[model samples]
Target: MTISMNCKRFAILLIAVATLGCGNQNDIGPTGRVNGVLTNKGVILSPHTQVVFLHSQGGTAAYGGTDEKGNFAIDSFNDGNIPIGAYRVMIQPPESQLGAEDEPSAEELLENSNGRKAQKKDAEFAFKYRQLSTSGLEFEVKEGENVFQIDLK
Candidate 1:
């Protein structure tokens, strides 16, 4: 009976230590929680759309995925906050929807032998921000919790 009690106590102590090591949001210094909604002419974006924020000066980048309602929250490593910086944003779709102008997969995107092949569904009907340099959507993320409603042109 005494041995069982000791084991239980040991397990509790181990769990407590692990929980404490997980850290809290307040512990993340010089970072901010970025929450935003992706919109196009006041309409919600398609589900599973991805957003990328690349630091203009380089070295840091943040990514987030949108839901059906177009809401998204960007965080570092699924736990920490994104470092404060000016980022050029790119709101993109999945590979199957890439079409021709943006090229194909990783290997195809790198090659320049051909320009455009297939036509995209949204090529003319809608606007798609796919390139880092041409996204034209710039945002500055500051400290603490930052929120923005990004409207794509």
Candidate 2:
């Protein structure tokens, strides 16, 4: 009986050790803050343009939005830092006034008055850099602060 009890305790301790070693460590990987300006033909992009940093290895993407001055900061995993890796950059132009005008008003949305409507028009620059596969823009995120000036022409 004594030997059996000792074996059971040893097994439990071994299992605990193994479980502790298998913890998720990806969240603890090295990361860095990224901020930059985006310009098109030497002019700053419009405010509220969406920017995305897609990891080259396939994982959760980092995202940001440009201000009126075309400044942005990349964020990932709910934090304002991106994991160190190579990333493909994608930029989505701000929604056009025509698209905004086509959207149902708050009252209509709340009352479900508007049925399905015509698709809104895409922005002039929507398809230009909105796709990571076609953006042709790439950058590397390191273990410290990263600043860049991206020009689209």
The best candidate by TM-score is 2
Model 2 stretches astray by more than 4 angstroms: 1-21, 26-28, 95-126
* lDDT to native, each model: 0.73, 0.76
Tens-digit per-residue lDDT, 2-110, candidate 2: 9999999999999998988767756657888889998887788778777788878856587888898989998776478777888899887665533455455666656
Backbone clash pairs for candidate 1 read none
Q: Write the per-residue lDDT of candidate 1 for residues 66-101, one digit (tens) a residue.
A: 888999887566364777788888887855555556
Candidate 1: clashing residue pairs, number: 0
lDDT of 1: 0.73
Separate clash counts for every candidate: 0, 0
